[model samples]
Target chain A: MFTNPQYGIFVLISATLLTSVVALLVAVPLGLMAAIFLSEYASRQVRGWLKPILEILAGVPTVVFGYFALLAVTPILRLFVPGLQTFNGLSAGLILGFAILPTIASLSEDAIYAVPQSLRQGAYALGATKRETITNVVLRAGLSGIVASIILGVARAVGETMIVTLAAGQNPTLTLDPRVPIATMTAFMVQVSGGDVAVGTIKYKSLFAVGMTLFLITLVLNIFSFWFVRRFQEKYE
Target chain B: MQTNSPAVGTGTAFYVDNTDYYYGSFQAVRDVTLDIPERKITAFIGPSGCGKSTVLRCFNRLNDLIPSAHIKGRITYRGVDIYDKGVDPIDLRRNIGMVFQKPNPFPKSIYENIAFGARINGYKGDMDELVERSLRAAAIWDEVKDKLKESGLSISGGQQQRLCIARAIAIEPQVLLMDEPCSALDPISTRSVEELMQELKERYTIIIVTHNMQQATRVSDMTAFFNAEPTEKGGKQGYLVEYAPTQTIFNSPQMEATQDYVSGRFG
Candidate 1:
């Protein structure tokens, strides 16, 4: 459909949605558990050393992660799964999830830590086990912040370009199949902006249009985050 | 020094023998030996830094939550060593409940606050009835029965403290440790809590830590006064100065320090 631009644009949008969905599936549970471990279980010395190391994953260049996905993850995935392509959304989305993991984990850790110590004491006084206190009290109190972090992670996954472009290949297909090659909206923009398309042409113009679409998606998520926090956040004095 | 007054006829509930509390290397309170009587309101009265609250927390093993805090001696509840290797603080806390200086209700609704303790302790009874019974016993049922779904924080501070009390009692604990429970309340609220103590002592043993000497005299059957002296490192070390029936401590004390403190002549 690259020869037919209209159909290709639709394919690019679907690829973006599919990849982001995959990324969130990988991130949410892993990130949240990591946050809880860091906040509730880790000693001060362990947290002091471990938190910065986890954040360092966020600072690593996306280009490096792109290559690591292409060269490292895809080959390993190919050994287990049948019909897996060298450039597939599975590998790209998995790495994209890792790339944004620290955002969710770090922010969520901060939120869980921010829950007042009195609440924990109150739960303990009631004979709540550590797991019960965390799940019943701490998680409920920190829900708004935890959700906000996930939304921010979603924005990062949606806008992520280098990993999908380098690892997911330049094929715009209207499919949710992770094992197949796909090109996200960001990947399409990268393709058009490489000086291959002439100025003022349809392909070049589509870059700005796709950029606006990405902006709107993230803007909607952020606005929803604000509304959600206001609506559901537990008020504590 | 230990005091087992003859006026304590109900039998001993907690036996604290030569206990020394420490935060890491620094000793906070030393050699605190006392017998707290069952089904009675025992007050620990002292100035700030005297470790009254610290000793109260030790009863429920709530002080175990602090990483560096440790105790050197024995604290037994009904002849069971609470700090024994086999003892789980979680289970011990079910038998012994605590209320803080600040009224700390969960951010959940009023009904949820009362129900949470019961639920966690595996209460299979009707939750609605349990909530009502607990709130009624705490004397806040009339004020809060209408707004059971409202957040616990939505109420006034006095009502919130009562709600916390209701939450604590919902699990039907055998003992209740109150650490300056009325310190954050107004005079009226304090009076109400003091009265509640009078009623609660019929069923459960109570130990309170308070700065108000009058509160000790008004509510407690027995009183233990703690005094703190500065160490060489400039941190205060708390020790039990006197323990006896509240009447004797206030009217005919054994120690000069107890006399000075009860008369407001010394801290």
Candidate 2:
């Protein structure tokens, strides 16, 4: 249906990339801080109670998250950015970040907590503060795990469907501003599939092409993360 | 408190008086009284589960890491009660360093590993010289000096232990507490570590825990022997059986149990 392959592909790819990048910017720092609190600072009783709450957030269906973002979060965004639309990439991404919080936070906690207790003791015995130990020794030691956690979170954000489909609003013109409407590849596929496109048409075939492209991107990310984890093990073990 | 008791002496590096430690409701050690002298190597020798390590950890308050682990009675370091409410464990630990049974190095470059503690303690001195001097003091400098930028885990197990000792000493702590510093190494590494301890005692007070009776006798200036008795409900409770000069503890122990343990008749 399109004369140029790069014409549709570039804009769609950038839209997908932009949405995930915006989401991760919000996710990584907040997720890492929460992971640090869960692993290092929380007492056993507090951890037991707090962790399941995070899991419940993770367990919430993405379609529900899409609805929440479309209805609730966009209004809040509109209050701050006057140019924000009813359906905007910024709101979709921010809410998607919260949707993936438990994935990043819980996995990062596992990484941080997997650092040997002896390392913590060594830091403590040197008269290092708790912050020093966590940042220098524990976090540094668990670097691979933490990076892997982030990469996995990236993969999740890239592959997420319902939030982008509903809230991002399928208008895939590539602008860097997140307050504008955008169409993720996932959202565009949903848009076309939900409508009446004939089976043999290029519009219908473009769905498979887009699906293949997203699959390739996510596959590369997963492979890279696994490779990183293996490299970490080879060094530490 | 017998007349010939070594505890009678005024060796004031640490004065642990009636120090009882508990893990939750279970008392692990009872009525531990000893004085670790300054600039000397003190060894704690006992069988497994005798709480020798628990007692050694009290010297630097390392046992505080355990949530349910609590202690009663007095432990003084240079006239300050380490367990006092006013004492900050962080400041206390800076003055007292530790080497674990297994070498525990930060997963950083050897240079960074040695420099980390000093940096966090706000060391304003030339770090290169300090890292060199600390590694030299630990006797692993000549071996590791060429690869300063390599990860600490890149070294051999024995060299890693010495690096850990270097990291601990780089902080300029006054006392060094080692929990089985050589239990994980080969005979050659163990001997070198023992040699390092001999050299280190001139600079810092060293307290070590070991299950090896020979290791205790060989390296320590004074030795404290611990023995355990099973409580009524099938748990072991450890207590100090004797404290004496290394020579006396090895050659002629005062208590029957100490004699029995050193003679290898029973643990």
Candidate 3:
């Protein structure tokens, strides 16, 4: 089958943008909640146990997440959202969110912990309650760290490929609706490679264009995360 | 030879009675009792681990934050029991501010450092005037006035300690606790802090803990000597060995331990 060159470029652009938007939407709330839970809610013993468990979540292979998304989450969603497609962005995005939750939680915990003990004591000595101390002192002190973690989570989501390819349907429609099936740039690469496109063809050349766009997107995200962490380098001695 | 003139009449400021401090199973300060006078500087001088700092922390209940630390006994401020269940530790600290041994300034602008305690205590009027007044009172306003916007950490070691003093007094505490406030400073800076202390004593009762015997003799009107007492169970605890006017404590100490310790005979 002859693949149209124009169709390939359009699919690449549509997929990249769709993936980025979905990843960002999922990363923000999940990551922020994870950070708060780990840093503020968890007890020292619970934190000792839960943090490593979260890291295991982050360490789980993308292929395992893809399998979970395809085999597990889709079936669950089918019960409520009737007519939901077998492979959809929602399942993949949710699983990818779980995968990156640890990045947000661990880094944010480090940031919150980095707040000086003296400052916390100072706040408490001023008659501030536990909630007040956490809100006014700990969170304020750790703002830069939290911002850096969110950027890192976003970067991880944007760059993820395996889960998106297996779970997200290879339909390149440029719509914001998570309920509808959509293809991401990573899925397109897998689709193109699965078929027999002759060497040096425009079809083959289209992958390079998609590859370049993905590279730039991930590079920009990486740079952003780096700068954010550097900006808030802990100054307490 | 800074003015040895006793500016304020000797009136009771603090009445720390039968106080005991425990760190888990071990007692750090044992059955201590003493009086601090209003508008005067009282120095606690002792060898290392003699609970001078520990007792100092008790005045403001700063030890409460340490999970293992426990206190029993009465520390009265203006004749009110500080350890009373209704006495808020925060309010107690606000009325009795502290300066640590090492200079610790917030990682903020110099102006904000002085304003932090006041803001926390809900000071709502004349923030600029209050900040300037506190700085001038601490005697660092002239050196740092133009650079109020600069980071507090950017100042010299001596200047940072004074900034801490300003930070403490911004809340207008009735008493100031100094835990070796000059130990980390040079002679020049130490002299400046000593001068500031003398000036501050006119308005606030000052309790200073110093490892330097000369510093205690130079700045305090009264001096308390703490010594380690070995327990039957084989651990050491700290208690007041002697308390007297600085002149008597230094020139004519009543206790052999105080004389031995002060005369460089023993720790």
Most accurate candidate by lDDT: 1
In the range B1-267, model 2's lDDT, one tens digit per residue, is 002224322456888998899999999999899988988989999888999999888877888889899998998877777888888889888888999988888889999999998999999999999999999999999999999998899898899999999999998888899999999999999999999999988878999999898898889999999999999989999999999999999898889899899999987
lDDT of 3 by residue, A79-157 (tens): 9987778987778888887877788778887888777777776555444556766876677678888888877877777
- How high is the CA lDDT of each candidate model? 0.91, 0.88, 0.81
Task: Tell me how many clashing residue pairs each candidate has.
Answer: 0, 0, 0
Candidate 3 Cα errors over 4 Å, as ranges: A1-4, A7-43, A67-91, A125-128, B1-10, B229-235
lDDT accuracy of residue A25 in candidate 3: 69
Q: Which regions of candidate 1 fall more than 4 Å away from where they truly are?
A: B1-9
**Model 2, A38-105: lDDT tens per residue?**
99999989999999998899999999999999999998889999899988889899988998888999
User: For model 1, what is the alpha-carbon lDDT of residue B99?
Assistant: 88
- Model 1 C-alpha lDDT per residue in residues B25-49, reported as the tens digit of each score: 9999998999999999999998889
**Root-mean-square deviation per candidate:** 3.0, 3.5, 4.9
lDDT of 2: 0.88
Clashing pairs in 3: none
Candidate 2 positional error at B168, Å: 0.6
